[model samples]
Target chain A: MKEEKNIHTNSEVLVKVEGLSKKFCKDLKTSLWYGVKDLTANVFGNKNVRQLRDKEFWAVKDINFELRRGECLGLIGHNGAGKSTLLKILNGLINPDEGKVTIRGRVGALIELGAGFNPILSGRENIYNNGAVLGFSKKEIDEKVEAIIDFSEIREFIDMPVQNYSSGMKVRLGFAVAAQMEPDVLIIDEVLAVGDIGFAMKSFNAISQILKTSAVIFVSHSMPFISRICDNIILMDKGKMLLKTNDVGFGVQSYFDNQKLLGALNFGEENIILNNVKIHSENPRLEGIIEYGKKSIFEINIDSLNDYPKVKVSILVYNMAQINVALFESRYISIKSIKGQKFIFDFGDSFLSISNYFITVRFDDLDNKKALVVSNYVNYRSFQVTGAERLVFAPLYLKEKI
Target chain B: MPLETRIYQKENHLKLGHLFKASFKDMLSSRFLAKQLAVRDIKAQYRQSFFGILWAFITPMFTALVWVFLSRSGTVTLTETGAPYPVFAFTGTLIWSIITESINAPTASTKSAKGIMSKINFPKEALVLSGVYKLLFNTCIKTLLLLFFVFFYGVGFHVSQLFFPLAILMAILFGTTIGLFLTPIGMLYNDVGKIISVGLSFLMYVTPVVYVIPKEGLMKTIMELNPLTPLILTSRDLILGNPPAFLNYFLILFAVSALLFSVALVFYRISIPILVERSNA
Candidate 1:
């Protein structure tokens, strides 16, 4: 009977799940009348799918987990912190008003990667229509269609028509046919946050060669690709699992210590005001974060509503995909009729690497040498940096001895 | 390594014999993703047409030439259709446009595969079997224009007209069993696909496709309680050859439309994961 159910059992759990949940409604006509009363109480059986009716909610709660054959879990949160509804209920694509998932062999989902592309066909016929919707088999997409047209380098526009290619050559031929879907468990949403960077390091090395014999889960916000191929993690927020771990760097440092610190200070056209914006960090841990190449300072205080022999402030910073890595400025710190004045700056050994950052500041008017008027603010302040050693890709680790 | 577990609960603990044996084993492993999504939707449906595949023989020869020019200018009065009213109204609107394109092929092939079923988890019975393989490739070009209108209207051939592809596969299995029981409320309401194309054009003016079933009053008792009047009068009497005037009411409406097409494929596999979790984004 199919070779007694093909019994090759090495580390075998494959994926378990359990206490999972789903809910969700936030009104689309009362979530389509609670999806036609939970699909007529689940097609006439009517077990009443455990509570919470009107205005629903729990977009995946109680989500327990498991994964064996070469484990990898990770699912960190924020962005409706349900982590793509628990990877669409572990890729069965929905249905978990309560719990229990199971799964075993075949699951593959690096989501929407050319999901059945056919922009008038032809990228070698959408690689056999996205390799027969990722289940493969037209003689295994004709023996992996010449390595998916040589890892989607376009191969002279693989016979033309995918609506004339370019959109980074249709996301590098949809990540080379979802990296030739081998599938044992694999899930991976945020399909490597979309292309470009040598095809995201050749699809992160074809998803680390299909994560060395499957059993993944992933979902990300890229806490360094979830601390590089996660061993286990969870985090999630609004819909439960505040933290689950197998350490993966303290579950990605408690998902950046449950991030919320935006540190508001807007006063746009209020000219110049703020009285204290600190950020000292000699080696501050969690709460203030900053440790990597330690020495920091950012004082500020300020008041100057009018006089100015010179001013020029600037700051900038950013990162956390906000990009603008670093910049400083200052030089003319007179603020003539200065009030609370403070000023500081320093930031000695701050090479910037670990992560979280913000800061926009700006105050000018160096006697209008066209440095015109003053005060600006936007995303005013925020901070976090912690290291010890982990700079695989570097946003800024410049120790510069070379 | 085909361990094959796949549990996923909450459908009242499933087990209707494992949901009809996993919906007939994912409709037999979605036959090569329903023939590669019906050859990538029949080659992107005629690669942006320009008379490509002659627009499926010019849409049922232009709705049978506007009902053969409104019953030859009588403006709509019609009766006595033994065969030859423009080849019996172009084989009754080419078998009523293959039973209204098999009742709009399982909700227009699951709404043009709603962006690949909300980010892939295949075997959605390959989008209603790739809409019955693009309604049998536009019913093989409306069966070669109903064999060139039964030999250009002379209406000769007979071996029971070789059962006209089994009466066009019993009008696409009884219009895909009431379009798979109106595709779980037409994939959750667009008013059940605009009330099934305005109730199949007012149900093609009460059945008999383009007039014929009337032999008495009350429009022949509403065309004998219209179950598509024995599948368009046995596919226009096996395409004008004859001997099939409701052959036992077309074998009891093809055994009650093959038992309502296996109860509309087990109510389309228990309402497609609750209509894919309320039509996911």
Candidate 2:
């Protein structure tokens, strides 16, 4: 089945990482001492190698993947899931403790915006400096300088010191330089969220232009953006790979499901508590797929020890990346009597896209200031927007008159 | 697509020749970047200062003036330097400053770029090369000042003076060799930079910078033992039309400097990444 699904007949692998791992020490003094010891061991003919020592742990381990030309790989993980560490290792900013990474062709990275820019230098000068740091020749920068400045939209401020440029301008210029370099492999780490929406669109268009020829590895918390750009996805957790698949929808669903199992939600200490939460459709037999433009109901069961004066219930719908997509709240109809009551949220028509989503149930006071019970259930249920046109740029399908 | 890059843990067995060749090529490819960095530093070094580039010559010139005043006041007895006291002291201090500045340049440059180094991957040799460029610029300014001092003191020019630039170059190479060796350590610990600053000032007195080396004494023996003593003496001899003294010692030291610099480059290539990672961690 896997062989049959292999689509690219002439694609070549641009980046191959095999069993790569990196260990980091928690304590500064111990880390420095470990560095010295490692250096000495390298200098000497000592072959003894241990994976971990005191105060040290693997930040990334046994990560294996191959990126091919014209492919965009999405790296989805929660914070501290070793995504940044993996990017650093691939970019050659840091060394790995074990395994090997073989890369073909030049690698351009927007790892951090304006990372190598000298604040005292003018924007024009920093363009040259940044290009050089990215391994561009002076003649190459000279040829592309005008286009870079034009793309950044900071032509007027090009002669001003970079310290004077705003943060948005800095990112614009940074992305321009990296994009113009035409690297064979491009690695972007959540740098697209910078600038206003217009600039973000422009930058994404530039990325798409580059995607035609170069392999890309991008990490973003925006699921919509990921689905729009990525052809393959890898889900990571606590320095380990959990899933790697080409189906963007399934990969996003798996990521949310894993987050639900691992993330510990902080519940409020109050008289009322959530007993259970379930999603139901019109057809009781149907499971795991909610067809678009159909009715769906969220049933939340509450268990209370005593009656309360005023109580409100709310259900928040979140995308896999934990971004809130919709909210269902019982604000107008208050629960004066807090007996074990079931709150049913009915949506006339569901417009959610084909992806995983989270349901967070919360019982709050009358003013919504105090939470009686807070339960964050990630990937509580997943639905597919079947028989509808796929919306890759956004999860919500709003009816418009345009 | 013609090149394949593989990264892994460094091996225990050192390939000295391969390391040298690779590092040399990397440094050569990064020359334009190094030039940009150097240009940034040179422009920023004096941008906000009122004295601007004058500060480069003022400090050493003031030191020379103090020594000349003391010598004329007869408060401190001094051995006869072959040239006029002011010219001798000025030239000596100027060369000594070049040594000290070159030694400090690499460490300072690398430290300042620590933020960028940890965040970005580039040919780090560019930083060292940029520091060298700054040293060359400063040395050129100081050389012009030295010419002024020679004319002001009415010291006649000699054909041998043509080799003065070579002497200065040697001093810079010697200092930069030591500096490159210390850069990794200096970047790791703040104390290394502080100690160098204080130690270089104290070391000046032990070298024959202002006065001639005594014929026989503890200070003379210490001065003779100092490696910089021969370098400074040879540079001064070359500029003053005297057959350079300690030519054999200078030759030996030059060879040692080259070897140490090569070794330091290897060590630097290996250690800098670790140091940068540690700092970020």
DockQ of each: 0.26, 0.50
Could you tell me the lDDT of residue A265 within candidate 2?
Answer: 45
True contacts kept of each: 0.75, 0.57
Give the count of colliding residue pairs in each prediction: 0, 0
Candidate 2 lDDT score at position A318:
70
TM-score, candidate 1, chain B alone: 0.37
Which model scores highest in lDDT?
2
Which candidate ranks first by DockQ, i.e. highest? 2
Instruction: Return the lDDT, model 1, position B232.
Output: 78
lDDT of 1 by residue, A1-402 (tens): 123323555577889988988878887777777777766677777656588877778887888878886678888877888888778778877778777899988888987788878888789888888878888878978988998899988899899899987788888888888888877789888778566787888788789877877788888766667777778888898889988888776666566547565333454455677665676566323445667766666778888677777777767776644556776665676775657878766646675787667667777775636776477775555677777855545334222111
Poorest 10 consecutive residues of model 2 chain A by lDDT? A393-402
Per-residue CA lDDT of candidate 2, range A1-402, in tens? 123223434388889999888888999888878877766565453355556899988888889999988899999888889998888888887777777777877788877767678787899988988888888899999999999999999999999999888989999999888778676788989988779999899988988887877789999866768888998999998888989999887788777666654343436654555555656567745644566657666666666665555665666677655567877665433443365677666655676765556666666664445654533432344444454745545424222111
Candidate 1 accuracy as lDDT: 0.77
Clashing pairs in 1: none
